[model samples]
Target: MTRRHTTRSSVPRTAVRVLLGAAMTWAGISHLTVAREEFRAQVPEFVPLDPDVTVLASGVAEISLGAALVLLVRRQATVGWVAAVFFTAIFPGNIAQWMHHRDGFGLDTDTKRFVRLLFQPVLIAVALWATNALRSRR
Candidate 1:
């Protein structure tokens, strides 16, 4: 008989994961509704799709990922990696926002936008850390 050994996340990690998931879900919903125009401002001019379409698609993706993060405890590592990648993928849009001086989400000043750019990596790291993605499987 084979015994299954399941590792449990620490309390802090679980809390962080839930918070991140909730935040992402809220942001995604905003992307589709109240903050649609603000989100569109983040889409880089170089992206081929129309800004609204990109916003909508990304909103859907965020919602799915957020749900996965919260509900898929066993698959948390995978979700974490995906979330990290998503954050990385959208980083260029943040840069574009800074470069183009597009105002959105209270990032009215260039310094504010530039400072916001620094948070993407933090979010990526948090996602990975919260889900044990940074840990090695034994």
Candidate 2:
């Protein structure tokens, strides 16, 4: 037997990719600036690097990855792989912060903090999936 699949319209596909890219790009910049302290507060105490440096470096990396996602969507496979790696790389920071969980972020408990950490991976997955799915249509 044979199976058939439909493709997304160009407008919706373009909208999805562009919007995802723009959102992530803005978020990355926010990480570098306004969110830096909040992110730094979450940095696990055990990490050897200074919090400021770690925050700066991570922010820069995020910005770079977000840009790549935007421009590289046409070549989805490459962008998808890079996005996956970037997401995985930063996960430790999330874990560390959750482990330390000292309030803020309006969280009532450490468990809530941990749940928050899950947001990163989920977002990365969405970004990667959107790009890859768009690629599949071509």
Candidate 3:
């Protein structure tokens, strides 16, 4: 079998990926700095490690994943898959926060928290679409 090469993806694809990457980078920065303690409120109570550890580790993961998404253009599909998985993985924390009524990032109202919950899947879809990971099995 011969290997296929992709020089560059479409402008829209690149834009979406870059935007998502930048958002993640910003979030990771907040996680490690000013919003560190606030981020802990989103950690699920069942997580075995301290909430701070979870927040910090997730911050690192976000930064790494974000950078990968931004830089790994040749492997867009792979990066998208990882980013989607990461989004899926952290969804529970969002759920826990919503369910527990933990306030952060101005999501003080229950309605706001619930509305935010709906965006998680959208992020996953954007990740896949931006990286061309969403494909038909033709």
Candidate 4:
């Protein structure tokens, strides 16, 4: 017997896509300006790149991913994969920050630092799932 396929709706998918896209876009902008210094402080010493360059590159990458997420939301499966991959790509920076345990960037404490690290993966999963939902309908 063949299983039935369900048609996907675009309304919910568009809503989620817009939200994640706008949020990440804003986050990328913040990293480039308002939070640049804070991000600079999070760079790991062993990353083998200049702090300024790293921050700038990261901000650009973030903005690009955010744009992609927005544009590709309708292609849920593809966007899910892309977002998941992007999230994994940035894991190192989080690990570096947690391991280094430095202060003065603007974080309240080491606990906050580590907590933020833990949240990255979760955000990725959400992005992936939201995108996937959008894709399923198409």
- Select the stronger candidate by TM-score from 1 and 2: 1
Q: Model 4 over residues 1-104: C-alpha lDDT tens digits?
A: 98855447456655776788778788788888988878877777877899888888888877887887788644656766777777787787777777777663
- After superposition on all C-alphas, the RMSD of every candidate to the true structure, in Å, is 2.2, 5.3, 2.9, 4.8
Encode model 1's per-residue lDDT on 1-138: one tens digit a residue.
989654555878989999999999999999899999999889999999999999999999999999998999989999999999999999999999999999999999999999999999999999999999989443
lDDT pick, better of 3 and 4: 3
Q: After superposition, how far is residue 133 of candidate 2 from its true place, in Å?
A: 7.4
| Candidates' C-alpha lDDT | 0.94, 0.70, 0.91, 0.74
Tens-digit per-residue lDDT, 24-127, candidate 3:
98899888998998899899999999999999999999998898899998788888999999999999999998999999889998999999999999999999
Off by over 4 Å in 4: 1-13, 104-106, 133-138
User: After superposing candidate 3, which stretches have Cα over 4 Å from the reference?
Assistant: 1-9, 136-138
The TM-score, computed over Cα atoms with residue i paired to residue i, of candidate 4 is 0.77
TM-score of every candidate relative to the true structure: 0.93, 0.74, 0.90, 0.77
